[model samples]
Target: MTQPLLPDVRRPANGGPKAAARNRAALIVAAREIYAAQGLDAPLSAIARRAGVGQGVLYRHFPDRDALATAVLEENVRQIEQAAAAEDMSFADILGVLTWHLKESAAFLGLLHMRGSVDHSEALAHALALSDRVERALRERLPDGHRLGAANDLMLAVAMVSGAAGGPEREARERRAMAAWRLLGVEVGTVRPFDA
Candidate 1:
């Protein structure tokens, strides 16, 4: 018995169609690995392999690499909604959670670097509505100072930390991200271990 050498294109039998978000999310995560290891040179077949799905499933979910990359990114930002999970809190708590999310998104940033495309403009635009919601969430938690700047800084910082130019190396990116976290009033790592 031999497995098909060719990319499997069929989806697993599902009597009930899974939610699009979930299916796409699995594909997106798998694609991220493919893109990261291959640095956008990864083929759809490669992604299918990494995803443990069929080529047909890959194609059905994402028509091409660009679409897959787009989906990968969309999932990245979508992951940030957890920042608002700590509803009804002080500004400090709100900032703390958002900052922690910045680190959480670090892996996604690596994926973005691997994708190496500037197609996130549309995604960013779409996130604006959510951005407003996020800002409002932060505002609700803050007091007189009410630094809405944290919202802006957080978005940019996460993007920067995840971006290629954000840091020369992983350690540097972490340090920079933590610094940005502090600036945004988002609590993060207490001290650089290097000091030890």
Candidate 2:
């Protein structure tokens, strides 16, 4: 069956009415992929195409690029929260989850760096708060003497990973992330063989 061009734009903003929520979720998923692949300057039309929706439907949910970017960050924050809250997750696991997110969402994280210019103040605040929560959880999981340093190093790791340019710098980025873990005195290649 052929997909609809756009979500039924007639739905409400709460994303409550099933169809609207589905469209919103699809747009978010598409936006993440598009932004990461094409950079933040990518046209909204491209995002709409990727989401298999019309531009109007995309606008209905995210009035502007910043709005869509905000949604992406919001989702990233949610993922981090879930990882941090996982009871079975160890410190290394949490760090790995966060590091992987940083690598995957490097472009979106760049949007976070453009704090003042973007109209995503609320979203930025939410992301920052979530990051703090992740760091706090990691700190709590750290061995007694390593807590503070580990937390500090994790933050540094985020900066390093987020600042990296993809493609040629991909290896460098991975190295820097692992190096930050090493800075925390966490043994790399033990919990995960990330020696690459």
Index of the highest-lDDT prediction:
2
Candidate 2 lands at a TM-score of: 0.67
The C-alpha lDDT values of all candidates are 0.53, 0.64
| Poorest 10 consecutive residues by lDDT, candidate 2 | 187-196
Cα deviation of 46, candidate 1, in Å: 2.5
Residue-level lDDT of model 2, residues 1-196, one tens digit each, is 9976986567535545787888898998888777766677889999999998899999999999878877887776666567657777666676676566555555546643443344656756766665666556556666566544643565655554455434324456567667666665665332221221
Q: Runs in model 2 with CA error above 4 Å?
A: 1-16, 111-134, 147-151, 164-196
- lDDT by residue (67-163, candidate 1, tens digit) is 7766655554443344434454444554444443333333345443333344667655444544545455555545554443554553454455444
Residue 83 of model 1, lDDT score? 41
Error of 1 at 131 (Å): 6.3
